[model samples]
Target: MLFDLARPLLFLLDAEVAHELVLPSARLAHRFGLSGLPGGPLPGRQVNAMGLAFPNPVGLAAGFDKNAAFLRLFAAFGFGFLEIGTVTPRPQPGNPKPRLFRIAAARALINRMGFNNCGIARFVENVRRARYDGILGINIGKNAATPIERAADDYVACMQAVYPLASYIAVNISSPNTKDLRELQRGTALEGLLDALGRERRSLARKHNRRVPIAVKIAPDLEDDAIPAIAERFLAHEVDAIIATNATVSRAGLAGLPHADEAGGLTGAPLRARATEVVRRLAAALQGAIPIIGVGGILSGADALERIDAGASLVQLYTGLVYRGPALVREAVAAIEPQAARMAA
Candidate 1:
């Protein structure tokens, strides 16, 4: 309700400006424990997946708190887990401004922000400085100018930099904005990238005496054949998990909505069915060979449970939280508990 009231004022500014401006205030709210001011039943629930124990399964996805900027805020809002970055090894300006668009009618967003971030070093510093006590995942990407052929090196470098601080690391090979980024999802290319990171995971584990999970985030804009192939490669390479279905480049789901023609990834309600389908396909292929973290189009408790029923062990949210606010999280978590009890029965 507060966010809805603020949206008229927020929407008046550039989308990106509203994003940066809102986060700091949220952080301040966290500092003062203002987040607890709203009266409600506490939503603290424990969930275990991917060999890590999450306080709850609802998490803020990669793009929201890029560079780990709003950990305190998201933690305060009761997210069980928080992911930050799509950070490259070195800093680079993403696509020009005006890259973020809100499709209010559809409760969707179309963005080509291009992974603009403060790079791994800055990200490490910020994350190290944050006071959040929940799970943190780091999403890493390659530089926009990096050739597709050399993408493995970039992923490895990012892993090396963030491994110490990250509870888990997400290899973001799905963002549509970077030139040829999705190409890494193809057969031989995908194997090579995962193999390189797999080797590093072992090396880091031996050095630190702790193994951090590595999850691959893939796009929903894939052929049926591609999903299984990627899953097989994941099993073969021993990749820890998969974030089944990132933002969709195919606008087939949101055809008549405003900005449906927007030239970037599509997320929100229109993304629900297709993203759910992707999670179902992945679950069939992997058969829980490894856990799948479902992303895309989750705006309600039923929506979150539908993804879990479709075979996701956990779920992440981005656009839905933007459209619905923190109440959505509580409702979704509340919804999950009853279903979880029934499943146990």
Candidate 2:
């Protein structure tokens, strides 16, 4: 395939450099109407979640198109929906140069790119310029410099701006790269943040005349004892949905591998099982109270199905897309379709 030929060359460059190259080219390709995207789900793959009808349960996770730059490229790849950003109220340069790493042998990636993105002002502008018409979810986060106590203000500001632009707004309190961001996931902090967002959503709904569902993206690195209380908080707070995981801080399965010692979150094959386990536990605790968007290390059709089988209402791909390519999207659609059809029935 074309990507197969390009993979070797892409792998040869610095991970971030290759990424910087791919998106602009993809945007240009889409702009010219030149990409022959495979398109969306086959007949029976549709599944509704978070009050939206997904053409398929497969989606491109946030971070891939951090700036909302290539909806056309992804839509052509046939994603049921796409989540973009981890964008903040103000633009950030992220951590530092060479922040992205490749674990080629493990089919994984590790990144400490703190939420580097254009400010919400420009982010909304970019979303407004995109022409791809599928569902778009905007993932929001706090600026690195924001004091942990004041994080909600940043999230609230970003949420208010993105509410009209997003089909659903994902609050990312879990990514490990940002300083103390995960602390927001703790007991009172988590509860207070959710409560604040819940109140904001109510006001925004009245103002915009729409209640854009908000999903919290949690960390996979939670201690075994914490999952239940987290789930309880979600239910009590009436959070619309939960993205069971963000990339993990653990380097669990990559023993002695290259880039295995990187400082950022680990994602891909090593993360699949841990991520699926979170979905399983969340599903049990949630008891179907709210939907779960499972994402972490899906790399194949079977991997995608594993997340759903474990109770994720929907699944997303990021690291996998790097190792596999757009073909993986269609493969995921096919793999989940039967089970999805049964659920739909």
Candidate 3:
């Protein structure tokens, strides 16, 4: 109600500026205990995946709270978990201003903001100070300047810093905004990167005496034949899960629309089908060998459930939150209730 009314006003600001202003303000409200998670069919939606218990299957996707600074507030909004960051080892400014563009008619977004973030060190500090105590999944990525071949080094560095703090660490190798990052998703490259991450995860597990799960986040633009091979690598390397998609480079559904030709990954309603298809493919290939966190174009309860029906153990919201506000959270949980009930039964 309130958000819908405020949507037009917020929409007046540049997308990125509105994002900058809204999060901290919302965090302040949550900090003061003025915020509350809304209701639907979410009360009994607890789920256990990757060895962690999630209160619900709906989570706020990465890129929303990249530094984890608003965990307490975001956690209050009814997410089962939160994936923060695509943070690199060091801070970089990402791309220039006006990098984020909105396609209001299509309820979509195209961002080539690069991986703009406050860097791993500051990100860890933010996580340390956060009062929220839910399942926190930190997403790690390579710095824009890092060579594609040495991407493992950047990812390893971020994993080392965030391992203890994150409930799970998402290895993001598929953000189209970064140069050559998606190359890490190819056959031999994917296998080797997974190997390096697996080896490092083992050593870190010993040192920290806690084994944190690692999930690979992939792009949605993959060919139909490529998914099974990726699933094979995931199993061989023992990855804890696969975040079925990041965003897509294709604009299949947004023909002749504003910002349609924008360079960056396209997300929101336009991405729902493609991303769900990836989840479906991955599910068939993995045959339950590993879990999939379905994300991309989740703008409503039904959209969230579509991922579940297609075989996502969990679903996440990014662009949807931009379009629908917090109400989308509870609705997603409600939408997924039947699936959770069936599993429990």
The whole-model lDDT of each prediction reads 0.83, 0.87, 0.87
Please write out the lDDT profile of model 3 over residues 154-203, one tens digit for every residue: 99999999998989999998999998888999967787788889999999
- Per-residue alpha-carbon lDDT of model 1 for 1-345, expressed as tens digits? 556677688877877798888778766765776654222222444667778997667777899988887776777665778888899999988998888988888888899999899988998898889865578899999998888999999999999998988889999999989999999998788888988999999999999999999899999999988888889988898888899778888777566777778788888888899889999999999977898999899999899989989998888888887777777777666666765433423
Instruction: Kindly indicate the candidate among 1 and 2 with the higher TM-score.
Output: 2
Where is model 2 poorest over a 10-residue stretch in terms of lDDT? 35-44
Clashing pairs in 2: none
Tens digit of lDDT per residue, candidate 2, span 203-235?
999999998998999999998778888889878
- Once fitted onto the true fold, the runs of candidate 1 whose alpha carbons sit more than 4 angstroms away are 37-45, 339-345
Candidate 3 deviant stretches above 4 angstroms: 32-42, 338-345
Assess every candidate by TM-score. Answer: 0.93, 0.95, 0.95
lDDT, model 3: 0.87
